[model samples]
Target: MTTTTQERPTGTTTEHVDVLIVGAGISGIGAAHHLKERFPGRSFVILDALDARGGTWWTHRYPGVRSDSDLFTFGYRFKPWRGASIATSEEILSYLDEVIADDGLAERIRYRHRVTTASWSSAEHRWTVEGTREDTGESVRLTTDFLWMCQGYYDHDRPYRPQWPGLDRFGGAVVHPQQWPADLETTGKRVVVIGSGATAATLVPALADTAAHVTMLQRSPTFFFARPKTHELAETLRALDVPDDWTHEILRRAYIAEGDEITRMSFEQPDELRELLIESMRPQLPEGFDIDKHFNPSYRPWQQRLALLPDGDMFTAIREGKASVVTDTVDTFTETGIRTSSGEELAADVVVTATGFDLSVFGGVSFAVDGQPVDFPSRVTWRGLMISGVPNMAYVFGYFRASWTLRADLVSEFVCRLLARMQERGATTVVPTLRPQDADMPLRPWAVPENFNSGYVMRSADRMFKQGDREPWIHLREYAEERTALPALDLDDDSLVYR
Candidate 1:
């Protein structure tokens, strides 16, 4: 590959490349695979802030960390997940490592490279990217024809922790799920896990094994679903001697179809579906357990991401008296525990703020056009991948309703196809710009509030780009629809300005 070096007064090292991918996690690795397979002639580099691969998996090391979604869909479409359907964090990281080694992606990855700013130059038909090395504290610059953002939406540096009165007075060690300390001890301690989402759900069961007593403190209840660790389809296929790839496709399609059916059912007959879910889980809990109080959610299914308990592990722990759930708001933190809004006091040796995530768009990287800062919220989203005014750039944002990698893999394939089209036409730039006719289209929230009620997403709604009401612009959440539309999307569409 041909390269050029540019010198500047700021003492930053600069290099020219064809593509710059901003992440080394599942998305970036998959994107690199697509690039190498589909467009080998182009030179690209994967930059990661951390010194290692597995973006979120590498950072989050809390107990009982695992994927809520099944691995058949969460795993890359090209790669067959030959392990359990619900995989652990370590297992997921190992899968990523295997992919990296098998695909020889390690050669192209630049670790500890944190992207700080990206400025697009229309005249030059490239982006001037600036980043810092987390290890060496050296500034580096790269000018590339295209910028691919697979950095994900959540901020790893900050976890969403709500302000609690008298928190400082609490003598016990307080922790957040994001920055789990390696040396922290939980064995034989009374741990209080605050939050009702997936993290809290996973932690309570796992912590109960070692902790003297584990309490799940929740302000509101969330709908929970328990799935077996193994999939029957996978087992049957393996027994039938089906090829890994073939079995993967069969299972992937089946899982997608099932999820689609559930989504439809939840929207169509919410009450019936809610009752069915409650009844299904009722048998797993102890008799006379308050199903309506602790298991039922106010919002309909799929309103927020559903919590998945692998192999009914959480319920089993609860029934065994190793764990318990407390439904009440925290009025204040006492010296040794918490005071509840219901005038109840709970004693604890440790408190875990499993609050949630601090959401970010474009991974908190500032974008500029021709030296002018770009206002992300002012721009409309183009097909959930690219911002309308952003040129030659695309973000790999996965679906909340389905496996994240399903959408990510599709985005990679679509980008490669689009790049090929651009190369064939000898075009240097392609930007998704709203046509004059698209002015009056109704603007929709990135995540429609009625459908999604996640705290992090709702809190950062104003900072995200809006989606349109029509096709080619509307960000569809269904993998079935996107899988068809994205691969077959027209490169010469009026919404896309190709040069």
Candidate 2:
């Protein structure tokens, strides 16, 4: 919230920083905390595109949005999650603010600063990051010894949209969920929600309560189930005199293990579990409702993300005639309404395009070395954190398995170890190995992409690391196991050699 407003020196090496964090989100903020704790004398600055500091938690100001996971595991290890399970977006933001206040990170953050392009300087052994301020249009360039990219995978510029054949001709108001117009009222209006993912599922039920009529349209279905909002064992463990942190770690592991088992057994033993899932839903569906159309997904479990509800009921809303799910593709957006492949034109006054997000390579920002473009795609992942060829840069990637904060926590802790290692060996820079492009690489769209930007990651597959058998990266799902496997506190990994 505060900064040293001295003019940055131009055409010369100005401020000297030990590390430059390119985000003010949970990951970047967490990284800064770790760095300060490990090396108090080291100078580091956390930059964010928006004026706020919570990153994605700051950007997504949508309604009915809350942590799908528990707050205990979703929050940072350095900070305790004092709230109950499944915190609202506002609660999460307030908690983030508290984290900032408690850690004295206000002065360390630079707001309204969006990084444009980052190029490394091989001669000076530093990264030259460029970003412009949204308010005054002033630009700031900073060179640092190390770079930490926690900006996430989505791009806010171009909202993710599928090739809806007639989007330009849609007469009714069409809105992407990412940029949901604040003032637009859906009250008593016929609203159609596209997609069956978390966004669509959550939006449909939430909107149905207010809208005159609500319909959820999806080309493919998801294995939807109502989940318990609270965990009894977790509650018991917390009250059993177990360390809050230890209980958090254990519960995190149990949840991850449970999800992994469910997913693993689905693929490893599909018929039995699939039947159980179907049996549970069959009794709840309405008489005229088709379960196969909305609940049956084309892909197997874990291929696409699953929707969660604590109350064990999203179907009740549909059963009550408040909402309806249609498993048909939106053939086109005609003048009057959305035309489905079944030739059914659902009349609507407003359309909520909860289609998905545009996947970008780290917030649609580019990287470079010595002012030259940093071709980061030509590298293989090392421990899913560092690349073999890129030096002194680490990316916090939380793919489908676990909660995002989990890996971000690990990355933050590992960054602390990395800084200590650099100091111990007297190394000015740490670069991961950037190998030549692998000809045989099978690119899969595994991680959630933020925007629809053209990038190598969009054209890739899950080569990073799997989460044993779950959604986000499998290995880092459990905090306890992750604590043991991540970067050593002493920076003792032999794989990390100082140049």
Candidate 3:
């Protein structure tokens, strides 16, 4: 996979390759492996905006930063995860490093090359991608036969922080979990964490170890799944001297099956499932605690992701009087603490806003097709992999209810298969088009609120691509269904117009 650079008349250098991948994170690295394994002759290069690899893992350095999803499923399908079920960010990054080194993917990656724009030319039958080097701040241009977008769907630089009145008057230091300060001291300090998602759950227990007291202030409650860090099946398999590969596969399948059942119960028996989840936490918490006020969520289980509390550590911290929970809205930020709507002033020295992040479409890269600016929301998705009318391009949007890597691996295989088909037909360009039957198909938001309504997804609904109400056009959130459906898709179908 050789790349050639030629000087342009404008005094800029342009690199050319058969495929240009837009990220070097988990998805991008997985895509690279697939390309090398199947299409070894194709020239490809990976461009990433970050200074290093491990997109989210590298960016987030907050206390107790870890994977909410189990590592067995979160890890790439091709690689075996021998670590604990719930892995820290460092462990995950180490695993990713091994994959890059073993597959020789490090050289193919260009870190700090932030893509700014991408333009597709029908006449030239190629895409011209433009960006700047973060290290040198110089413009970089590249052209490719196929553009693969593996950038994950969140803004790493900016976090979604809601404005509260009198925040400017707050005397203590305020921070967001996304951009945790390295030198910030929490030892023996009163800390108040905002939001009740996975980040807050992970932070409370971790901060409580050093902080005088850690309080989790939330606008509402979120469901949490508490279990031991190590999987029982994994231990059993290891005790039986099972091979790492076999154990990985077995545990992966076992978790997926269990998750599928829980997902099904969330819809079919929501009330029962909700009670069971709340009951599971009852025993973990102190006796006579107000579980209903703090643990009960309004939405059904699996409506959004359930935060995993390994070994019920957070509850243990609360029981030990090191941390506590507050279910109320923030009235305003006081000089030394936050004032809640219930007329309670929660004193704190440092505030950590775990209020989540903003979604980024295509890494916020401006795109144009044949000189016309691409309006993503106006276009429809093709099997949730490619957009209709976008030629020679594919993006990875993972499943909301499952481990994100599951969909990433599936998309890589589908893209490879599609590329192979195009090669066999000697086609230079292949674009998703609306077939005769799809002309009148009702278009819906990429993710319907009824199916999965996470805050980020709902907030970015207007900017997301549309999904059709039919097969090969809608985004299937079910991994089990997509595992079979995506591979069985007929590349010769009229929906994909190749020339």
Candidate 4:
């Protein structure tokens, strides 16, 4: 939320700006636009650690790196994605490029400028943001009334490769999915994909047709399901030859509604959702495949990430004998390949380690309040945007299953409202207290979170910005709920302490 104090504390100078946004991801871009609407005259800038914009999308230039969520919900609210329901990586990249260019925000975003640390000064009523240019190793700093961190969670934009026991024993070239070598060859080689999350699921299927044999190794079973490719509502609209924008909105709304409906059933007891998923999956299995052990997951639906189709998804690859799932943890890495707990050594020429991403807070930057370390993990968030203790800063988090743009769109609206209100009141800055003596706030995760994927969920819930447990504080995934919540603009903040 954009809020500044009317009184700028004595003794502050250099680059006097109203807001300083860190990270040029979608969230940061969205914040800039809203801030413009709220206070057009104020000086603001978005700094990126990398030399380009688009945050994760811009940074992650790996092979077959497309968004898992549908494109309709993924695009910004003000702007629309006028093409395919499921967009490709290149297409999504184009869309982002178009948005930035159209908005005339390319200049506002200083690429290769990364924020290293943010220290709030209560006496000065400003935040001192330190950044560096990785390429030139040049240091730059900014002091602004408010700071916003739209940088995403993944700390290691590089990849997470564990020291597998006897890993050096394997003479084969190992590759992390994050940093897939473009020039390296993987064709006709036996490939083993370690780790069983969305990344692993997408990576395995995409490689099956080319690789001699692709084996998926998992420590435990994770929920696997299909993302419906085309909806009936979308098809009908397309038959009418409606404009892409009109059809996109229709499909976006339908997907969101359907996704929320299905996701709400994610936590049902006795695993009803899991049972139904299994029942549907059983029909597609080969005649002799074990139903309970091979496919059936011990965890409930959404406990693990629901895998999507890289190329017609998991079933087609399995049915065609291009891919296989093995439920065993890796004991160690051998020169030849991986050694499983079952004492089975899989032969591999190329090993693709699709192990997950590293978790980071504020994009791996130190968060300080009044020059004191702001332990966000211990703070309860207000409206999933602002922390209770840190008054003016907002961390951008996206939806779990729904279109990330949906939540981001709402955040834009709320931030605009906050800025307008502050401007009207002549408030130059504001900071919320992270420590609430009266509130007993349980910690939570941020991102497209589901209770099912405990591994991923466990990492995100507590450290990321979270929703308030009470009515407006809770982030509602439903389309209708979000429709009302976002763009509402009226934040009743009896609890928000403004200085």
Query: Tens-digit lDDT track for model 4 on 1-499?
Result: 3323332344322354677888777788877877776577777888887777776776665556677777877877667667656666778778878877877777778888777888888788778877677888776667787777788767746556677788777899888866767787778989888877777767777778788988888777666666556656677877888887788777777777777766778754437787877777766767676667766777666655576663356677777798887888888887788889899988889888777776677787887877689787666666567776786777666665566677777777777677667667777665554335446655455443444345545655566556555543455355446668666645445555556
**Which prediction has more favorable lDDT, 2 or 3?**
3
lDDT of 4 at 2: 36
lDDT of each: 0.90, 0.69, 0.93, 0.70
Better of 1 and 4 by lDDT: 1
Q: Sort the predicted structures by TM-score, highest score first.
A: 3, 1, 4, 2
Could you tell me every candidate's TM-score relative to the true structure?
A: 0.98, 0.85, 0.98, 0.88
Clashes of 1: 0
- Name the runs in model 4 displaced over 4 angstroms: 1-14, 37-39, 228-236, 268-270, 434-453, 459-483, 486-492
What are the per-residue Cα lDDT tens digits for candidate 2 across 1-499? Answer: 1222234546432455768888888788888888777777777898888878776667665557766666766787667665566677788889888878877889989899888887777678877677788888887777677888888767666667767788888888988877877788888999988877777766777788788999887777777767666677667876787776777667666776776677666557767666677777887778856777778765555555667755644687888888888878877889888889889989888988786765566676776665565454544456567654567888887736457777788887777777777777888777643223333444332434431112234443333321112211123233445656674433544445576
Best by lDDT: 3
Question: What tens digits encode model 1's per-residue C-alpha lDDT throughout 403-457?
Answer: 8899999999889988888889899999998888788988888788787879999
Candidate 2, residue 183: CA error in Å? 0.3
Off by over 4 Å in 3: none
Candidates in order: C-alpha RMSD to true structure: 1.3, 4.9, 1.1, 4.1
**Of 1 and 2, the candidate ranking higher by TM-score:** 1
Worst 10 residues of 2 by lDDT: 465-474
User: So what's the TM-score on candidate 1?
Assistant: 0.98
Model 3: per-residue lDDT, tens digit, 1-499? 6788899998889999999999888899999999999999889999999989999999999999999889899999999999899999999999999999988988899999999999999999999999999999999999999999999999999899999999999999999999999999999999999999989989999999999999999998899889889999999999999999999999999999988888889889999999889989998899888988998888889888898899999999999999999999999999999999999999999999999987898999999999999999999998889999999999998877789899899999999999999989999999999988887899898788888888988898899889988877888569878888888889998889999
TM-score, model 2 to reference? 0.85
